[model samples]
Target: MRTVRVELGARSYPIYVGEGLLPQVGERARQHLPGRRLMVISNPTVLGLYGTILLEGLRAAGWEVLLAEIPDGEEHKNLTTAAQLYDRAVSGRLERGDAILAFGGGVVGDVAGFVAATFMRGIAWGQVPTTLLAQVDASVGGKVGINHPQGKNLVGAFYQPRMVIADVSVLASLPGRELASGLAEVVKYGVIRDAAFFAWLEEWVEPVLSLESEALIHAVATSCAIKAEVVAADEQETGKRAILNFGHTVGHALESITNYSRFAHGEAVAIGMAVAARLARRLGLGFSQEEEERLLGLLQTIGLPTSVPPDLDPEALVQFMQRDKKVRGGRIVWVLPRRLGEVLLKEDVPLELLLEILSNQA
Candidate 1:
């Protein structure tokens, strides 16, 4: 297993990436604490896969384990769904010292982690991420949230996990399109930060897409390390860490405009990065056509969609972006591409320029 640590002082934890790590959850989690009830929150699809093994392992170790399975997908990321899981945790005899086990992909992690964040005014939660997107991004950062009607992730909190276990084995069961969707975030790590990592990915994207064991592990490990380093620097996105949202400002708006169904999170991000680069070039941030082409090309090579969802009103998209969390003081704080491997946060982007970008990219 490859281990990466998110150093948050008291909340510091390690992310373990390897094949068949699902069966090792009992041992890995016990290493964090002792004699606590675990409320395992997952969705039906994931529960049908690895839930039994995890239950058995913890049972064998004599830990009381309870299960709460929510329906899967981005559509379920809301207050009602979160409430059901919260209800289950409370009825399962949860205590302040007990832990909540988030046992699926990003959707599961986000809602379950939010439960952990709010349950008993914050309790221990560990991540057992099964999707590539969750393993590389969501599961590591401690930025847990549920989507509100107003926008995605509007109802949430910054609650760090006690540990994160990413089992490569579970990813094998993920359908092809879902796997491709996850790669969008993986590619984001390379685009906004590490040129060398991006180069490494250029060579390995095919192997990783093919689910070659070693390549996937290496990719997940490196992506986690990049996020960990950033999270340690800015746990609440006060400064430098905002660069991680290079594609997210517009990407989140895309998800919101589409009501989170028309496009996958990563797919929206794939398109968002392309648009942001054009905006960057417009603002003279040094990104050029070559950079935009390279990014779009990489996304296509990985089976990720680079096109914006058709029929979305450009004005409606702009209206949604105005409500994004990153926006402040009547200025959209766009995380723009200064160049490959570096991003710049610019405020007060002109309305006309942004609208023109919408027209072009849309």
Candidate 2:
């Protein structure tokens, strides 16, 4: 196993990435857990697949484990689901010293983390992320929350996990489409921070997508390392950390506009990145057509949609973006690309330019 540390001093945590790590979760988690009692939150689908092994591991470690199986999907990520989990925590006798383990994908992690953040005035928690997207991006960051009706992740907290175990073996069961969706965030990391990584992806992405053990481990570990560094530098997103939301501004707007029924989070982000690149070129931000094509081509090769859906209304999307958490004082803040592997957060973009770009796409 490979470990990446999110070095937040008092709040430091390790993200473990490798194959066959699922059965070792309890052993690793014991290092940070203060008590033997814990609850695991998972979706029905994931629980059926790996819950037995995880529960056995915890039980063998002398830990008492309780299970809370939530339904699968983004629509269930809300206050209602959180309340259900709260009931489970209370009935299961969870306490401040006890930990909550998020044992599924991004949705499960967000909801379970939120419960740990607010339950009995906060408690310890760990992550056992089962999906590539969650492993590479969501599980590493301390950010956890449910979607508000107004926007995505508007109701959440920066509650870091005690440990994160990302077992690449679990991804073997992932649907091809779901795996492709995750590549969007992987691509985002390359675009925003690592030019060399981006160049490497142009050749290595295929093998990674094919789930070759070495490539998959490297991709997950590197993505976690990049996110760990960013989160450590700007734990609360007060400055440089905002750059990590490279494709997320418009991406969240797309998800909200569709009520989160149309596209997965990473798929929406893929479209957002494509749109952002085009907009950057139009505004003379130095992104060349070749760069834009390369970006779009990579996304397409990974089976992600690189264009906005046909039926979305530009005006509605803009309205949703205005409600995004990143917006400050009613000004829409965009993380626009200057070139491959580099981006800047800008708030001075003219409304006319935004409208022109959105309208043209419509």
Candidate 3:
């Protein structure tokens, strides 16, 4: 197993990436979580596949387990679902001393973490992220929330997990499109921080896509390490950490306008990155045509969409963006790539330019 630590002082935690870590979930939880009680929040599809193994492991480790299954999909990530989990927590007599375990993909992790954060004013939680997207991005960060009718992740908190077990072994059953969506976040890490990692991905796309052991470990470990460094430096996204929002600005808007159905989170990000690249050029941020093409080409090769849906109104998309969490003083903070390994946050992107980019993308 490859272990990457996110150093947040007292809130510090380790992310373990490897194959066959699922069965060890109980032992892992015992080490990090404070109490013996654990609520395993998952979706039906994931529970049906690995529930038996996980429950058995937890029981073997002397945990009093409470199983709560949320229906899968981004659309279900809302207050209604959170309230259901809250009801479960209350009925189970879960206490502040006990912990919660998020046992599925990003949606489960986000919702479970949100419950952990809000229930009785906050409780310990850990993440056992099964999906590639969750493993690489969502599971590592402390950002947890349910979406509001107005925007994505509009109602969330910065509650860090006690530990994260990113069992790549579980990803074998992930849908192909879901795996591709994850690669978009993995690609975001390379684009925002590591040029060499980006080049390595370009060279080893096949092995990574095929879930080759070494390539998969390296990809997940590296992505986690980069994010750990960023999060450790700026835990609350006051400054440096905001760069992690690289493709998220436009991506979140796309998700909100589409009602989180048309495209997966990673697909929206793939398109968002493409738009950000174009915005970089338009804003004279020094991004090159070759670099833009490389990004687009890589996403296309991995079966991700790089263009905004033509049917969506560009004006409407902009209006959705106005409601994004990153909006400061009503101006969206755009994380634009200056080059492959670096990005700068610009809040002054003109409305006209954004409209033009969106219109052209459409």
Q: Tell me the TM-score of each prediction against the true structure.
A: 0.91, 0.93, 0.92
Q: Rate the local accuracy (lDDT) of all candidates.
A: 0.84, 0.87, 0.91
Candidate 3 lDDT, 194-288, residue by residue in tens: 99999999999999999998899999999999999998998888889989889888898888788778888899999899999999988889999
| Number of the top-ranking candidate, with TM-score as the measure | 2
Q: Please give the ranking of all candidate structures by TM-score, highest first, separated by commas.
A: 2, 3, 1
Better of 2 and 3 by lDDT: 3
**Residue-level lDDT tens digits of model 1 in 1-362:** 89998999998999999988877798888997544688888888898888889888877776788888899888798999988887887777788888888899899999999998998898888999998889998898788898877556878899988899898878888888878888887888887788788888889988998899899999999999988998899998888898888887778788877766787778888888878887888888898788888888889998776656556677888887776544554556788888788888888788787777766642
Clashing pairs in 2: none
Q: Candidate 2: list runs displaced more than 4 Å.
A: 323-328, 359-362
The CA root-mean-square deviation of candidate 3, after full C-alpha superposition on the true structure, stands at 2.2
Once fitted onto the true fold, the runs of candidate 1 whose alpha carbons sit more than 4 angstroms away are 323-329
Candidate 3 — number of clashing residue pairs? 0
Residue 113 CA displacement from its true place in model 2, Å: 1.0
Question: What lDDT tens digits, residue by residue, belong to model 2 across residues 80-115?
Answer: 999999998888888888899999999999999999
Model 3 alpha-carbon drift over 4 Å, by segment: 323-328, 350-353
Q: Give the candidate order by descending lDDT.
A: 3, 2, 1
Q: Mind sharing the TM-score for model 1?
A: 0.91
